[model samples]
Target: MPKFTGYVSDHTKFIEELKSKTPGMEERQQEGRSLLWDKLPISLDEEARTRESRLRQNAYPYQNKF
Candidate 1:
């Protein structure tokens, strides 16, 4: 298996910690879902949507790359 780094590794560890901390199945499932949303590349459409949303929200300064 390939090793994850940076934010991916951090979030993976966070989800594991969350699972260890939570006892209920539903709670773990919810936490897993949240982590999946943050980390997984479920689809290109989802990826594009996330990038577009972040750009619109001005999470980073806009720059023209032309």
Candidate 2:
């Protein structure tokens, strides 16, 4: 198992700490897709082709849709 940083052992204690340290944190959540279309490198086309080949090599049958 992997452990995440800044996590507490107890849930209640974690919530209390979070509330005191970062008030109104829930109001700042991201609501929709923020485009990164301009940030992609020119080599992205080549990288994507490589990724598609790799995925095709390890393709598995679709078992469910939800």
Candidate 3:
């Protein structure tokens, strides 16, 4: 088996080209991602309270019994 060295895939090339064309693009992407995805650590009490407050759905929710 031969390993292909110094070979850039099309996807990698596209990303590199995009980054080169747009200055601070990576930083903006990071900021956007952090805004949506980055989160502070949740305390155990908060997590337990959140879990305990959830309402359970009845089985066979479509059918109602009076």
Q: What are the candidates' C-alpha RMSDs?
A: 12.5, 16.0, 2.4
Error of 1 at 13 (Å): 0.2
Tell me how candidate 3 scores on lDDT: 0.95
- How many steric overlaps are in each model, in order? 0, 0, 0
Give the range where candidate 2 is weakest over 10 consecutive residues by summed lDDT: 29-38
Winner of 1 and 2 under TM-score: 1
**Tens-digit per-residue lDDT, 1-66, candidate 1:** 976554567788887887777769676677999986767547989878888888344455586545
> Tens digit of lDDT per residue, candidate 2, span 1-66?
977878666987988799789966655433222342335465988988888888443254665545
* TM-score of candidate 1 on Cα atoms, chains taken together: 0.28
Cα deviation of 57, candidate 3, in Å: 1.6
All candidates: TM-score:
0.28, 0.27, 0.74
**How high is the CA lDDT of each candidate model?**
0.73, 0.64, 0.95
Q: Model 2 residue 47 lDDT?
A: 86
Ranking by lDDT: 3, 1, 2
Best by lDDT: 3
Stretches of candidate 3 off by over 4 Å are 1-4
